[model samples]
Target: MTNHSHPSTTTTHSFKDLISMRQAVQSLFLAISLFMGIMFYLFVAQLESGAMPTLERPPGVEAFLPISALISLKYFLFTGVFNTVHPSALVIFLIVCTTALVVRKGFCSWVCPIGLMSDGLAKIHSWLFKRPVHLPTWVDLPLRAIKYTIAGFFVWSVFFKMPLAAVEQFIQSPYNTFADIKMLDFFTNISTTSLCVISVLIILSIIVKNFWCRYLCPYGALLGVISFFSLGKIKRDKNNCIKCGKCETMCPGRISIMENETINSLECSACLRCVDVCPAPNAIGFSLVSGKVPMDQRKIALVIIAAFLTGITTAKATGHWQNGTRIQAYQEHVLQDRMSSQPPMKIPANTDPEKMKRMIERMRQKKN
Candidate 1:
């Protein structure tokens, strides 16, 4: 006689479990938001004041998004580091890109401040509209290309031009003075056209979930392309699926999880919404092998270990995780000395080119 076992008993996870999982991931997202805000503030402060007290980058910055890969690319091609090599930029970019490999754009969902704001806006849109809205495919696809175009422009700017004098000026400019801060006063004083573009993007993000990431964020586009080879992925066991469709609804990307069973590597963010919502016991999970590992408790420990190693290795390589406070204090002192020596100079009412040149020379001397 064959004994029949009920599936419900095998997988008894409840809504509370799903909520707990969401909270865990969302808290991580919050931490990332806080970190980005700090970075943005630093960028603004350095640019606005034209001086900054030197502060070492936090270890987490080495592997953060937009920084590492861009820096690595710059360093590799020129045999010199550019904006990509700055400690904060390098760490953030690395973390985003590497995490993308493990969890398919997890950085966007779990770390990006802009993404968090977009997510919040999406909720507001839903509440106000009282319905979920989707853009038509024709319009959506074309708009998504914008991000790629932006990425291309940035890459081209760095690689295509070899203007030695201009590059020298930029390299020696406030960028280096401020420890390679990307935010500049000019950015804060952006033209109307730029403001319009940013406004449109934010508006679009509210209208559509992940609108910027899906189509227009050059950084996300770059990372998505890199994520093609990420090891960990969301895998679905087709035989075990009961067509619940919960995963699909829960997916912020709006991917059809029920039909495909396999999450798209380029689109999935490893938010674990699908995993927690899955009713099938051990049916959906992340693994190096497709659908092979369930990411059980033991593997979760391994994942933490891997993340830690990734962080530490990155910090050590970039001089961000250095030991002792005395060295750090010295670095801070040097930065302060540099800043105090070059307070923002008011331009004199000059009537001649010679006078302007003299002023420029004085400024250059101060910078040096």
Candidate 2:
């Protein structure tokens, strides 16, 4: 038997350093998201205050409108036209899905703000429990299916149940166009029920590592399903058979790395925790193909970043990154009482005067 005790000389950085690098990447994305949120709040506040927004609305804020994006996606597929109502929402959605196909749901691990929160809660869990809490396989297996079921329901509703015309109508609806603002209100003006639900989730996260990601996040479920076809995967070496179980212990996905030569599990986020914990040389690593040498963690990180940046750059160049919704429309929507039974028609601010006049007339007719 080959002695796999010697650490592979593939990368000079230690496992701890690799983990630090990942955390740093996660922090950078989280900071960007926070900045976007602040900018959006200022933009909305200006609108509500009846002042011209000094700061332009950050199109990146539309990333929160995933349901709108899904509707836009279906409409696009059916009509061969991209919806400008929230183009960035669809653009961000596509970027996320593309990353999953290329990097195995790395978005959940490296980019999502929610993932960062979950990681922080997991640390609290570790401090509280000392040893990691492991749910029994019987219970765990069924719970893991919940996210998939949720994802499936959305996909089916949008793709199978709704007709093409309905999809287009939904994409063009006032609700879809203003979903980002609604999402912001959801957090800024959270109700008691929402607060209680969030509190419970936070508590559960402290007790169970990645409770939301493992069982509830429909977005993660969609990505996980797409990641089944990811080019890269965690591969284990059986020949260098020193299975000390460190890899399994460290895996957030709770996957048994030693049991399989190739990890094709949907739950595997390709977070590299298993690779970081493996002590034996060439015993476990991420590979683009079966039986190939594993790529360095630094290289994998670069690839993931490059993929996202490239997608964003392409979207920007193609004029699909920003919605055409004008500042005026947002201002009107903000100032008006949206809770009224008859909300005003949401026309994009950039529409021609004649078109706007006709649309307003049609809305008036419908109301009367």
Candidate 3:
């Protein structure tokens, strides 16, 4: 590979500017998520108190229900119909998956609230340690596989083990209908076991950069697997590289970008830290195609935003964004004092079996 010896040139903007832009994007999504959480809590509180909810339920909160979304996705594929219980869950899921296919786990870096929290913890890790700790390959490799194994188990259970009828049945079950409320309670009324697990993960993250994201988030593993087929990637110009190793040092995923002309590693989160830190001009950047011109951080930000907005907008226009489940369903489910236990895999109380049957028949007719 050819090498350059010239001094690093100044670009239009500094790496800090790029990082600030990413932070801005992350902050926006985190704010939205928090707002949704607050709104949903109020809505549920009203329902539990035997009062009509004045605050409309925020459908965006459904984004947290990834397992329900996966099952909904399979149900849609098998029956050619969207599950109305948590339609936005599947929509957000698709949007995230699309980002992975186009931008290589950009959702993890740009959109996820957990990612924002992880980034914050990573900064703390940097402050605590003079040099970041990296586990040995033997330990790291197995730890990384933990996420894939978790993802695999879910995919296998939902897509392989569950038959089409069972998928439909589960979608209509009380568990799926009230999953969002259960998720809220999981945090609001945090259990001892859950608290311990979260505390341990937080402590580990403070010591190791991106500890949970890199080794535990099955959702991230799913995105990483899909990103292998993404058209966009971080490309390294071997000719202009100075072999300074700054890129690898700054990589959150611990990917060795200096060793590869193109970073095809599943761990690459498209965070652009490497690109921002590169001293050599045009040495490393995000590119749509291999050996092509690199895209600016601003443009990548716009693309991620646009992809999300486009997917949500399309789903809304097609009447697939908001769920069909009535607010009364939530109120009734909550008022029955049923929030304390896991919902049974049966038709929810206060739901009309005839109405559900008609709805399923309508879906089949539409398919035919």
Candidate 4:
């Protein structure tokens, strides 16, 4: 089954080095996420102050608006129109899904913020416990189904249930246009319930490797399903196999690497850690199913990263990278959502008239 005919020996990276490359890629994306968050926050803050924003809104912030993207995707399919409400959201969603079709769940391992966090927590689990924890099979099977269940609901609701009219209305709604702001608000002003749930998830992830990615993330579930048709997978060679269980243990997906000739599990992210830990030079490696040419470890990150770069470049060139929503509209929506319900502060009669006038003027300026 191993089609990796005489894999190249010149590559200097071991499994450890491969892991380092993965971390570097993860860090790069994480930094991009943070920068976008900060810039987006600043832009929103200016809008809230009823002032024109000094910074241009980072369209990448729309990446957090996945539901909006799903609606836009549907709307586009029926009407042949790419709505300007949140163009980058759809662009980002398309890029991510395309990567799944091309590289399995590599996005989860190399680029997901959650994946980066989980890796850190997994190390903590290692330090805190002497033995690796494994969930009982009977209990584990149902637990892992939760993500697919959640993903299925969204897929059915958007694709099968929502009509084109409703999809278009949603795309044009204030909720969709301002969703990126709301997403920021979800973090900046999180509800008690959301905080509690997040904390619980973190604690659980410490106890269980990748609790969210493995069993709770609808996004990951969607990617995993699409990845079934992915071009690249970890194909194993039976003849070159050493029976050592290192690959299985190193796998973040917790796949039984030795049992199968190819790592075809939805859980496999094609992180290539399995290739790194294999002690034998040609014992095992990632081989594309279409042909015998094995994918080099160094090129895996390049492939995924290049896919993103190419997609984003193309989107920008095609005028779909940014939304056409006006800044004035964002300002109007922000006040309508955030401040219209707020009552004016009652001025005490004891206060001076000039001070009262100043306060009232400030409020008027903010409302404007």
Candidate 5:
């Protein structure tokens, strides 16, 4: 990431760096996101076709519905009921927030699909320019506030403005219940305005290092604030004594690593690229409080994945992972919007014969 060019020795990566391992983890999660998108599309297709979905809806798709997650989070706090309408949304939100507390926005570098895309855009930025185009402190500092302002607006509106009753009502509202399908439709049937906006963001990301994450993402802004209290951080060993500017030039956060023993900037995503590029051994690492125990990209990736798996597994065990929206409700909502002619609601495929018989008879009785 350092823009300064030097005649350098080829660096051989050791287990201590493990940058590839971190990427593999990102790719794994990214692939999982794609799979969930496909499954959810098929599940919705079955519903619209008036057939039973042999494949269950992937609740992991709820990860994209963060506002619903925020509302559900407040509802759970107020009522102590983990509402079923968008249960997985709340579960995913809590899991991600927990990672910021433990590892300082590792979720951005290690898990989020956007983060992976951001990294690619950064490389493109490097290729397009001879040296990194950095904004001056006077301008950069003010721009950073934009995301915080955006995140603050949401926090204030949802957490402070909405009352307990309003929170409960939103969770049960038809909009919240059917949000996942609406999300699918948004992408599958994208409008011109949305497409143009997305293209602009991608282009900006390519021009500037992680433009969305650095200056515009509300989630990244919130995580950055939480990262101030993170348990692990980049710790530098000054006594090891190579004051090379490589680490600073390589830093995506644009932080000055040599000035301090610990890197406390909210912009640090725990990507560990600094550690990977450093020539001096034992000079810097992601270490815990005493600045002795090292956490490589591999170890942190495991911790991030473990945190997600544990949270999701516990949610499933408690019967709060899958949503409770009835299949009939989904049929009615999807077809109402998508189809012109109504088809007879059919028994879901691959169900017990007796159950299908009763459901068909029940539909017949309702029609008559």
Candidate 6:
């Protein structure tokens, strides 16, 4: 005779037991923090040389819309860095559309280095305060609306049938030139106003959890919208209900996962804390409806499509795409030339404008 029994399961988990859950969330946060550090170093290296990489130029480049980068790349490519009012700046304006679409707003939780830093601050706050801070819904909800208003103003101002020539002139100006710098010496020497704005944002992050992403980040608003269509979602199994309240307590975003099987796609980070902390097995999970999403297999394809359409549309409508190609080609040529004699050429502020203009004009003429 053989005796067999199912594995005994605990009905409850202590707060200490949730260490694994915390670590899981922290792990994602740490990975992003490391990535941001590397990016900061790379950006500094590029800044010293005065050359910005394609990645560096675009803020939130990997996000679905990446309007900041798109608009900036467009401006840089079309009119050169001397123009102050280039059409490429309109890329940040696409939040209106991104928000109305898929609600993945993963930009805040997943992509933005600054956003990640803000999250790290929140973690620190939890450690120091030893309690979660809760703002009234009336206060928190309305404050959240400010980002869109800022975004709306930005869009209306940039796209209000402005003269293309005027736009090109603005982007080429010195203020716009250093706006994309890494170490931001541009603030010290050229534009204190831009520097002050950046400084204030950094300080604000220390006091408020995701203050930048939640209220100020136009990119977050955009991704928050794209998240709506994301196939992978956090779901709860209501049938296995104990109403333990652990998931609600543990959620960083303060979402009540116990009540709804489907966490609002806009807020969930896919952090899996809800899943990991659940005393009941299979109560919460990341899943595809009907079939699994091929996000991994299809990522490259999606990126290509996103890049192509965003590029072409921004180009035809705003004429920034042509400029980006020209700038990139010139950069590649410069890098190759530097490799021949010295280290990778750090672009200098004193770079030959005539040479750059000639190169860019030729590319533009050919493309036309």
Task: Determine which window of 10 residues in candidate 5 has minimal summed lDDT.
Answer: 1-10
Of 1 and 6, which scores higher on lDDT?
1
Per-residue alpha-carbon lDDT of candidate 5 for residues 110-160, written as tens digits (9 for 90 to 100): 999999999889989999999998778898888889999999999899999
- Which model scores highest in TM-score? 4
Please list the C-alpha lDDT of all candidates, in the order they appear.
0.58, 0.82, 0.85, 0.84, 0.84, 0.51
Per residue, candidate 6 scores C-alpha lDDT tens digits across 1-368 of 00011011122544444444334434554575467446744654564464655344333222322334445544555666522233333443343234224224433443345655676787776776666666689988888888767766655555564455755555555344333331333422556777788778766665656667767766555455566676556666676657798877776567777777566645665444565566765555554441243221123124323643575476457544322324444354445434564655566898898998898799879845
Q: Output the better candidate (1/6) by TM-score.
A: 1
Tens digits of per-residue lDDT for model 3, 156-213: 9999998998888888899989999989989899999999999999999998889999
Estimate the overall C-alpha local distance difference test score of candidate 3: 0.85
The local lDDT score (0 to 100) that residue 146 gets in candidate 1 is 85
How high is each candidate's TM-score? 0.66, 0.88, 0.88, 0.91, 0.87, 0.53
Judging by lDDT against the true structure, name the best candidate. Answer: 3
Using lDDT as the measure, name the better of candidate 1 and candidate 4: 4
Q: Which regions of candidate 1 deviate over 4 angstroms?
A: 1-29, 32-72, 77-85, 152-199, 280-283, 296-309, 312-314, 317-368
Candidate 4 per-residue lDDT, tens place, 1-368, comes to 43344242235677678778889999999999999999999999999887889999999988888888888888888888989889999999999999888778889999989899999999999998888787898988899999999999988999999988888888888878788988998999999999999999999999988988988999999999999998787766778777888888888888988898766798988788777777766766665655365676567788889988998899899999889999889988887877664887687879999988898899889856
Q: Residue 87 error for model 2, in Å? A: 0.8
Candidate 6 lDDT trough over 10 residues, lowest sum: 1-10
Candidate 2 accuracy as lDDT: 0.82
